[model samples]
Target chain A: MIQKGMSVIVKTVTKITLGFILLYAVYISLNGHTGPGGGFAGGVIVALSFVHIMLVFGKEMALKRLRSYVLRGLTCAGALIFLYAATVKFSGGCVPFGAFLEKSVSCRLFNSEITLPFCEMLIIGAGLFAIFVALVLLSKSDRYDSE
Target chain B: MIEIHLILLFMIAAAIVAVEARDLLSSVVAIGSVGIGLSLAFLILKAPDLAIMQLVVEIMSLVILVRATMRQDLPFSMSGRWVFNTFSTVLFMCVFLGAAYIALKNIPLGGGDFGIASGVYLREAIPATGAKNVVAAITSNYRLMDTLGEVAAIFTAVVGVMAIARRVGRPR
Candidate 1:
C-alpha cells in the first residue's frame, strides 16, 4: 500500500512545487557570493526537493527522476570538480588552492569563488540524495523479506 | 533583545513538547518546530547564512525522520526506572543551564564587538574575494581547504552508507 504513494492532492502540489524548489536551490547556490545563502544550504534544499518527491510519490517514482547510477555519478563529479579547483594551479598564484579566476565586480553572479560553492552544492545534494535512496531501498527490502 | 528572548522561549517550549509528546509523529513535528525556531533565531542574530542552512537541514531531517517512523509499529518504550530517569533528566538540565549561564555571562546580549578576525573579514572580504557576502568569501575562498575536506568527508560517508545498505538489504 505504501508503494503506491500519497493522495492526489499531495502529488499535485508536489508536481507544481518541485520545479520551483529546484530553481530556488540553484538560485541560492549561485547567489552565494551576493547574499546569505551558499552551496551547502543550496545543496540541502536540493536534496529536500527530491525527498519531497519521494515522500509524496514513493521511492520508485523518485528514483525514476534521478536514477541510482546518475546520483552516484553526480556525487563523484561534484567531488572531482572541487578537487580540480583545489589542484589546478594558475600561473602567478602563491597558494595551492588560491583563487585562479579573475575577480570581477563585487556582488555579481560570476566570480572566482563561485566554483567552490558550486562544487560543494553539487557534492552535498547528490551525495545526500544517494544516501536517502540507499536507505529507503534497504528498508523496503527488509520489509519485503519479513513479509 | 526581547524578541530574541521570546524566540528562544518558544524554542524551549517546543523542545519540551518534543520530549514529552506521546504520539511519535507529534514528537517529530514538535522537534521540527524547534529547528525552525532555531533558524529564526539565527536570522534575528544577523546570520542569514546559518539560518538558511539550518532551515534546509531541518526540513531534510524532518523528511528522513518521518519516513523512518512511518509504517513502523514499534512503540517508544522507556526504561523501568522512572525515578532515576527523572532525576537524571533534571540533573542534566540543571547542569546544562548552569553551563549556559556561565558561558553567556561574559558576553553581551546583542551587537557587541565582532573581534579582530571578523573586523578584518568584514573590511577585506569584498576587496580580496570580490564577493559581497563575507561569509561566502570566508568559506569558499579563505577556507578552501576546509571546504574541500568537508566535501570529501561527505562523499566518503555516502559511499559507506551505500555499501552497508546494499550488504544488509540485498536478496541472496
Candidate 2:
C-alpha cells in the first residue's frame, strides 16, 4: 500500500507543477500575437496541464477541482463571446464583419509596447475553453470506465 | 534538400512499419506520428497555417480511427501473390516518381511576394474590425460566411458526439 506521507508529497509537487503550467498558459495566450505561440498552442498547453492533474490525482479529484458543468458552460460562453464580438462589428454596417478588430495598439497594458489585436484574446479564450471541455469529457469517460 | 530527403526517408520507414506491424494500435500510432512529422515539414517550409490545420485534422482522424478500432479486433495481414506484389511496387514507384518530378519542376520556389496585399489589408483590418490577429482578420472579415459555416459544422460535430456517447448499447 502507498504511504500517506508519500502521497501527500506527490500531491504537493503536482499542484506546484500545475500552477506553473497555468501561469505559463496565460503568458502564452497573451503574448501569442507577438510571438510564435497563439490561441491553439496556448489552449493545448492548458488542456495538457489539466490532463496532467487528472493523471496525478485521479479523475474524481480532478472533477471536483474542475466541475463538468463549469467547463461546459465556459466552452459555450467562449464561443458566444467570439460570436458576439463579431456581431458587434457586423451591426456597424461593416461589410464582411469582424474587420476592424485586428489593429495594433500604440501602447499596451505593460509600458509602451504595441499590444496585439483584441480578437486574439477571444480566440485564445475560446480555443482554451473548448479544449478544456473536451479534455474534461474524455477524462470523465475514462473515469466512468474505470469505475 | 537534406530535410526533404530526411522526410522522404522517414515517410518510407513509416510506410514499411505500418505494413509490417502486427498490432493495429501500433500501426495507427505510427501513421499518426508520420502525419505529425509531415506537418512539421510543412511548417519548416513556411506554411504555418496549413501546418496547424493539417495537425488538427490528422489528430482528429487518429482519435476517430482509434475509437472505431477499439470496438473491433484488427484484421490479420494477408500475403499476396508474388506477381501482385511486384505490380503494386512498380505502380507505387511510378506514381511517386511522377509526383516528385512534377513537384520539383512546377511548384513555385517560395511564397513569392504574396504578402503585399495581405499587409495592406492588415493595416486596415485592425482599425476597422478591432481584431489584432491578421489571420483572424482574414478569417472573420474576408471569409465571415465561411467562418460561420465552419463554426456550424463544429457545433454539429459536438452534437453528434453527444448523441453517440448517449447511445444505449455498445457497438458489437
Candidate 3:
C-alpha cells in the first residue's frame, strides 16, 4: 500500500534511536541480577528493536542484516545453554536443578546465577525475532500468490 | 496510593476513548496511551521491572497495530485536513507533557516493606543465590527448572512458526 518503508523522517529517527534501544536491552539483561529488569524483559526489548528496524527499513533490509537461519540458530543455542547448565550437575550427583556454579557476592558480573537470565535473553530475543520475520515473509508470499 | 489511583483513572479514561473513538488510528493511539498509563502505574507501585517490560511491550504492539490498520484508513477524508490534524497533534503533545510532568513530580520512593512470603524470600535470596535482586534470584535459581521449561516453550513456538510460514501456498 504505502511503500517498502515509511518516509525519510521516520528512517532518520530510527537510525538515531536504534542504537539506544539496543544498548538499553543489553543493560537490562546485564543488570537483571542487580536491579529491576530480567532476561525476558531485555529480550522483548531486543525483539522490539529489531521490529523497529524492519518497520523503518523494510523487511528485505532487515533480513539482509540478520538472516532467518542465524536467528533460529541463536534461539536453539540459548536453549541448549540453559539445558546444559540445568543438567550438568546431574553427572556429579548434585541435584539436577540446583545452582550450577558457586554463587558469588551480589552485584558482580561473573555470578553464575546470571546464566539463566542470559540464556533467557538470548532465547526470547532471537526466537521472537525469528517468529516475526517468518510471519512477515509469510504475508508477503500470500499477497503475491493471490495476485 | 493516590498517585496510583489517578494513573489508573487516566488509563480507564483513555481505554474508554479508545473504544469509543470514530477513527481507527486515533483509537489505536489511545489504546497505546492506556498502556503507557498502566506502565506509569507500575512505576508508581515500585515495580520497575514490570514497568519497563510493559512500556516496551506497549511500544512494540502499538507499532504492529498501527502498521496493520494504516492500510484500511488510507482513503478516509478526515485525515486529509491539515489544520485539524495539526491542532490535534499539538493538543496531544501538550497533554502528554503535562501528564509526564505530573508523573515525574510525584514518583514515590521504593515500595514499603516486603509482605509475609516476600519477607522470607527477601531474607533468604542473598544467602541462597548471592543475588541482590530477589526477583532474579527466584527466577534463575530457586525456580530455574521453570525457566528452562519456558525457554523450551519459546523454542517450540518459533519452530512451529518457521514450519508453518515456509509454505508458499501458491498453486503449483
lDDT of 2 by residue, B63-110 (tens): 545542333333554775878888999999999999999888875554
> What's the candidate order when arranged by decreasing TM-score?
1, 3, 2
Which candidate's lDDT is highest?
1
Better of 1 and 3 by lDDT: 1
Error of 2 at B157 (Å): 2.3
Which runs of model 3 end up more than 4 angstroms from their true locations? A6-17, A89-113, A140-147, B68-116, B166-172
RMSD of every candidate to native, in Å, equals 4.5, 7.6, 10.2
Can you write out model 1's per-residue Cα lDDT over B87-151, one digit (the tens) per residue?
Answer: 99999999999999998897754446747667788889889877898887887777767877888
The 10-residue segment of model 1 chain B with minimum total lDDT is B68-77
What's the TM-score of each model vs. the native? 0.81, 0.59, 0.72
Model 1 sits at a Cα RMSD from the real structure of 4.5
Task: Give the per-residue Cα lDDT of candidate 3 at B168.
Answer: 57
- lDDT (Cα, tens digit) per residue for candidate 3, span B26-63: 99999999999999988988889889889877886787
| Chain A only, candidate 2, TM-score | 0.60
lDDT by residue for model 3 over A18-101, one digit each (tens)? 999989988898798889988888898899899888888887788899987789888988888777766542233233433654
Better of 1 and 2 by TM-score: 1
lDDT of 3: 0.76
| Fnat by candidate, in order | 0.81, 0.03, 0.74
